[model samples]
Target: MTGQDTLETGESVRYISASDLRGFVAALFEEAGLPKEDARTVADNLVCANLRGNDTHGVFRAPTYLERVRNGLYAATPRINVEETAFAARSVDGDNGMGAVVGTRAMQEAISVAGQCGTSLVSIRNSNHYGMAAYYVLQALEHDMVAIAFTNSSPAFPPWGGRKPFFGTSPLAVAVPAGKEQPYVLDMAMSVLARGNVYVAAQAGTSIPPGLALDKDGRPTTDPKALIDGGTMLPFGGVKGAALSMLMDIFGGVLSGAAFAGRVGNPHMDFDRPQNVGHLFMCFRPDLFMPMEVFKSRMDDLVATVKRQPRAEGIDEILIPGEREDRSRRRREKEGIPLSTDVCEKLDAEAAKAGLAQLNTTPAPFAGK
Candidate 1:
């Protein structure tokens, strides 16, 4: 939802700077019981999502998180323990910690082990929503590794045939290095759109595009509120996407010893229960399979070829998977992130509860320009 509208009361919305918003969130987490480092990490990840134009996974989720912490559904100081196994694979028990912190730590371990054994697989259980999967996959780039990351969440959609929800809006991310151009990164959910997107649309009083979601009775719906309440998100490309989601559930959830989609409870509205989300991370040292230089060169060539493809009548340029997001991130980092009025209100309430000073109400230098 675009943050452009005037309510009946004729009040205009204000946007908060990304840094200020993140600082406010960090302070709230600190007050809620997270350690300084953990709080900072979570704050950075959330803000990064906003900067990258992924509002669904961004600071917009702060209110629900705060509510979860307040209700004891999430522990501020969780003990993240690792259980090692053969084949360079490991299992991580997040102990109900913030997903960003747990995901970062897990990817670090995967990178380290992959450096030694050529490849490593790490499965994590009991973590919360870790924001964008790209965040973790990109972490492996510095190590000259190809990274793959996946996560399974509460059921927001059904399996190919079934009416009831049975699969999480699972996401998959892959990152490949490039020589001169930006790294080739692909991050996408198996569903047509993320559940958070629907919420944002609903809050802004907008209707979603048709065929993206299904109503409570399993009929196609365009109403965001209906999709948010009991509706199910449609899988991308029908059965193919649903199949991939199931595979992600197996690799991320079952392998991590965490509950599957239908088994895991919703964390957004349910503040008193754990979500038991799961994630899988894999990193491969390019040198082990092929020369790093060769991989990077091929990736650069591939990206250039795709961008050179003919465009449609109205299209000016062909875009790569992560190109738009990377550009958006650079722009937002220099300017500031945007927030809807509802999100701003929630942030203000959270800041007050944590005894943090209110954020500046001025719009970011780059907003609406």
Candidate 2:
């Protein structure tokens, strides 16, 4: 089965199976000089984002990633090195590796250390733009450990009072294991929506809803391309989102000796130099205070209590955080991922440039073969 969607611009979208998408992306990366394993790692991360309904960070980014790797701005096979700073704290240098690869290794290090020390923090520097932050947290969940992830990007927004691009639309994710209910997974961006959302709109040639962005002169605008050109993204809730974004920079960039305070190079725009992105990953044993099963039971209770509460007007039901994404993942697993043809065409062009075959996509939506 497959899916399709229509955009305001009249561009049609179709579904691409996860395996086919992964194979296409991996083959493109391999053709661009990445090792087979590293290419698949990157593909998996991007496809997982798509499956989880985070299209802004999904395979839509293949062109930019391939460009960076081919140009040497992003290291294809980086020499990842880790330095132990404490029993439970480690610092990692990614050697400008692909952000997904760097992040996967760093989180694995965190899981290993937390297994031995009950808690661990692994700070990373010199990485590229990692995809959705939840991927790492989910990795920790597979090991039955609670995890938190933070990463700072190239600055694309402003602080509370200023309009100059000063803060990255930084994001953080957290996950907790549960016994009978779905695990708690939360991924949030400081901005009202990701700047990548604007890029997605721009690529589709559609107008964004008003007030999500401001022009360089601080006037509200709805033009996605305009926002990408010289405008800034509005942080959600004005000051609070700005504050959390700043906090992410402190944890992910400042502490890790990576670029911060509007200095991290933009992964898409700053091709002249490395992004030098930073990430902070923390994991802890859920059984630190009680039996693992008991902890999971409490988590299940937490979710049940929330779901049992009265629903708000027009709300069908109260859903725990990550439930929507979990549902999307399950549905996509069965019905393939819906991707805009514009994005598909771009990916196909990139594959052609690398002398690889184009991606396979379904023409109709959810039609049984």
* Cand. 2 TM to true fold: 0.97
Residue 263, candidate 2: how far off, in angstroms?
0.6
Clashes of 1: 0
lDDT value, residue 228 of candidate 2: 83
lDDT of 2 by residue, 121-155 (tens): 99999998999999999999999999999999887
Q: What is each predicted model's overall lDDT from 0 to 1?
A: 0.83, 0.89
Looking at model 1, the pairs that clash are none
RMSD of each: 2.9, 1.8
Per-residue lDDT over 1-369 for candidate 1, one digit per residue giving the tens place of the 0 to 100 score: 224543332334456677787787888888888899998988888888888888789888887887887888887889999889877998899999888889998998999899889999999999988888888988898787899998888887789997777898888999888889778889899888888888877877778889888888989889999887788898898899999989989988888888885777687765657988899998988888578888888888988998899898999988888889999888877666666667777887888877788666654355456
